[model samples]
Target chain A: MKPILPFLLFALLLGFSCSRQVQRIETDTTIDLSGRWNDTDARLTAAELVTEIMGRPWLERHVSKTGKEPVVIVGMVENKSHEHIEAEVFTKELEKAFIQSGRVRLVQGGEKREQIRRERADQQNNASQSTMKQWGLEMGADYMLQGSINSIMDAYNRKKVIYYQIDMILTDMETNEVVWIGDKKIKKFVKN
Target chain B: MKSYLFTLVFALVFCGFAMAQSSDQNPRAQQAYEAYAEKADNSHAASLGATVDKTYEAHDPILIKEQRREDRREFRRQLRLERARRPIIQNNPFGYYPYW
Candidate 1:
């Protein structure tokens, strides 16, 4: 019993010493703990792709031909990566870049657009005649941007390489013409 | 004791020979070595200079106007590609839902 008591004391000390630790880090910091898809990859890919897309000649041509900024709506960004990745995370980043550039106009689409329409319908009855929002006044999007994320992974024993590719394309809604195609490819070599 | 002394002497002789072989004696040889080192430094500088920094100047009115016109035409050509791909969204409320 005396020996067991000393062993228990040692175990408790070891347990306390081995306790997990956590620390807060900056949101934009590049941290690759498990060598998988992470915030850094999403941010870098979105930023680079958006920069390229905005800098392309298509934007200038659109503005010159139409004499106005092109109205764009984000359609979909499908995640087909080897690992589970949230496409929305990067899609929202792309949207943010477009809005921040002040060169493109964005319109609400999908469920959010429907919600706005529903509220406008409710306003038709509840709101005052002057203040009530009119129906059929929604701005139509002239272009749609969509993309897909794909990946290739190769592993040999303790060494592995992961390659991720994100492809985005902007299309003219009226002509169904693809205006621009931009891609971001990230490759990582991990060894254990 | 004899073997230890012999080993020490042998080691000292070998190290002395290595050091003598490494030292440059002739003034011409030393000059040649310095010249080679300078050449290598110059080569490295030239390699660095090969990486030209691209700068755009909008001061030239004619060049800028021509460049802008070319850019617009190129953009129209790129956007006029055949309609092979379609927009991912149809009537779906949510644009794209990830399958976990």
Candidate 2:
């Protein structure tokens, strides 16, 4: 029993030493473990897409016609990847890029818009008359941005390749015309 | 005793190989990374002025929160700098001398 106790202690120490260790890293640093959809992919996609979308001629045309920055509302971004990818991660980054560009104007949409409307409705009855927000005065969105993410995976034994494509489209709300289309493709290979 | 030593050496060698393999990147992945870096650099160069000069009309709550967090971090960093710059005082048992 005494001999076994020493061996057990050593094994326990080894196990503890081998335990996983985590270290905080810079957010922009690209660290791919499984080579799947990750934060780096989302960030790069958002940056590239914003750069491409903003450089396009459609924005200038819209501004020339309207004499004002185009107001945009973010719509759904569907994820059709092989893995369970949170589509909102990429969408939120894209939304941030659009808002920061100063060239485009973004309006509240989805549940937030509903919440604002509810607040306005509540204010009508319970709030003072001078400061109450009036209904129908909200700035309507001129264009709606929507997109989809798709991925293709090819694996053979210990070797694997993943290809992800993000496609975004902006459409005119009034005319139902597709104003702009942008896409970014990322491919990664892994071998175990 | 010989068998135990052999097992220990085998385990150590295996761990070494595992560590080496984990850090090894496939040639294709390396190529892809190079291409991605190049494209990113080109895109950044092309959109430099536009991105820098652009202005937004509305503020997203998330962005505002991030800005506030950054402000707090900057304030903490300034406090740390001030503390670091402060001179340390040593007490002399004999007297409160400036040299001490």
Candidate 3:
């Protein structure tokens, strides 16, 4: 009877455990990731902005189709939202879309470029004569992509309304000319 | 005491299985939702925008409701598929690991 009691208690514990919510693991979830991209909400907003920008036939016409394309770099994207939303998620998606479409040339953005240079320097110094000695190749960006995300929030205690607007502008590196612009917005409300 | 405890455990197991099975269906509905959203944005821009604004004002929970419904359907479909493919266990809720 005592042995049976132990087994019964063990069964109860196991059964209880199954009803609990699954534990969340530390992984990218669209909103919290840094360095590479922003959270999910920001990514969705960015994708919308990309769609808006691509819809502009006039902007497409202006973008030069030189056989030897100029490098394009991602510049600062300001977060003007109510919450600490990852803004780079928009830029990263924009960069990806540009690359995938095979429409524009892209250069390594921000710190990633510097890291590549540093790695190449180390390889050139340590590797033998047969190794590729290329480090910090001479490349200049023709345009810089920049953007911002802004939001407004109105809440009366338990009830709340949120509005998000994301904007992106592409500028000529040499002439400082604004070439293309895109924007996306999202509005959400919560109540109790 | 054992019979009552077993019944409670069985109920809990069934509830848990139901919840897990239902969760799997959300992705399918979500895909449908995305298509609906895109079409709405394209075809009826002004009206859809107004609708979206109104829903956002209320923090639209349509996604949540749809997801729940989807999960239930998927759970049922999965059970049907499983039954068709394999033998059923009639007596035990936890046939393999009863304690757990």
Question: Against the true structure, candidate 3 has what lDDT?
Answer: 0.64
TM-scores across all candidates?
Answer: 0.60, 0.60, 0.53
TM-score of chain A of 2: 0.88
Alpha carbon deviation, residue B43, candidate 2 (Å)? 38
Worst lDDT run of 10 residues, candidate 1 chain B, spans B48-57
Candidate 2 residue lDDT tens string, A16-78: 999999999899998888676799888888888888888999899999998999999877666
Residues A49-105 of candidate 3 have per-residue lDDT tens digits of 778756665345555444454457777666655456555556677778778877667
Deviating ranges (above 4 Å) for candidate 3: A1-7, A10-40, A57-70, B1-100
Model 2, residue pairs in steric clash: A102-B55, A102-B56
True contacts kept of each: 0.00, 0.00, 0.00
lDDT score, residue A95, model 1? 79
CAPRI-wise, candidate 3 is: incorrect
Docking class of 1: incorrect
Error of 1 at B4 (Å): 99
Q: Where does candidate 1 clash, by residue pair?
A: none
